[model samples]
Target: MNADLSRLANYLNPDKKKLAAKGITSVRSRVANLTELLPGITHEQVCQAVTEAFFAHYGERVDAEVISPDKTPDLPNFAETFARQSSWEWNFGQAPAFSHLLDERFTWGGVELHFDVEKGVITRAQAFTDSLNPAPLEALAERLQGCCTARINYRKRAKRC
Candidate 1:
């Protein structure tokens, strides 16, 4: 189903070739599904909702270059995302205000994931042991799509279930 990410992703890039190459062809409706869950909402409404959420989450406190959902596979989960977005390095890495190095070490599911974000971008990264080091990141990327259910229409739930 099309949710917010897929809806906006399709709107931003209508041609299927790039999406196919990146193996993300089905995201369009995924975005649609998210907003449609809210009664009377169209796909466009979902995009606006997510964008508003994004801005609300990161406004005033930081200068975000682009709030685009991570299209890359293996998006990070909420904890990882909260950490990433809340970090001083990720938030001010690109700012002229200050420059500093960020270091963190954590283990999840028997694997250690090490990451550093500088200048609002990932600068250093490494994964130890398990291969799902990327899942957290992918989960984070898909956050926008997951956002759709936040305001789903109560009646629609009965109809679908």
Candidate 2:
């Protein structure tokens, strides 16, 4: 989560936005290597080259404008909202209610499972079996409620059964 926030901060940082404002008229790439592009491979050299490239691509000569990060305004609740919206549960847990069926045959009997799913988790479970003992099946159905349908999660939960 910290990594995600850091990435968003870096990309949306004022310094990066200032660089973007300079605008690119064109970008022509030929068969070239990084060594050729930056002989020194230093931060200062890279910044200088990139700054020059922004103006060099254009036919008309224009003075480069200096942008202040302090002057840039921040959006309200953007980071928090973005973090929430990008979460796994927010994206996948909103799935519509559905039902799932699984049938399997063991040495003792054949079992059929019916599950009511909501928001990607099991809300209810019903099990039918041809075996004499139905206690295990009832217990299994009770345990299934509130379990997620994801294969890995289901596998971990199914271990008890």
Candidate 3:
């Protein structure tokens, strides 16, 4: 979670705000509480007035945002997969990547990842773990074979970036 927060902090800041139609007197402090508060309605959603707040907070501070972690909201599946931390191991693990060179690490309880591509597949890869089964990573690589539109699957995320 800390890693995810820090990653988001690179892109978000909380102290910035654009004033509404009101004059300079209400630049930071808006005229009246600009957000609409409901009566007995606990429905949670940011009023879009606090985009700065979203940028201000990175991880746990997201709890303070109207958006709840329980809901996936606008995050992509792979990103959400990386964000939620089930334990300290998940939160503190190293980020693996294959750039000009294949980069990975062996940490305590790190899951070994294997990649494979076939059927005009240009990439074949494997990893051995002293842990559980390896079918899922294999399947994921297979799913990307037809869609290898980029150099690698992680590269798709870079497109969005």
> How many collisions per candidate?
26, 0, 2
lDDT values for all models: 0.48, 0.69, 0.41
Task: Write one digit per residue (lDDT tens) for candidate 3, span 45-84.
Answer: 3333365466567433444423445654565674456466
lDDT of 2 at 123: 92
Residues 1-161 of candidate 2 have per-residue lDDT tens digits of 01233244434434545455766221221124455565647666766778778767875657665434333235787566667876769876889999989899999999999999998888999999999997778788888888777633655555677
Estimate TM-scores for all models.
Answer: 0.18, 0.43, 0.22
In angstroms, the error of model 2 at 52 is 31
Winning model by TM-score: 2
RMSD of each: 22.1, 16.0, 18.1
Q: What is the alpha-carbon lDDT for the whole of candidate 1?
A: 0.48
What's the true lDDT of residue 149 in model 3? 24
Model 2 CA lDDT for position 109? 95
CA lDDT, candidate 3, residue 160: 40
What range of 10 consecutive residues in model 3 has the weakest lDDT sum? 27-36
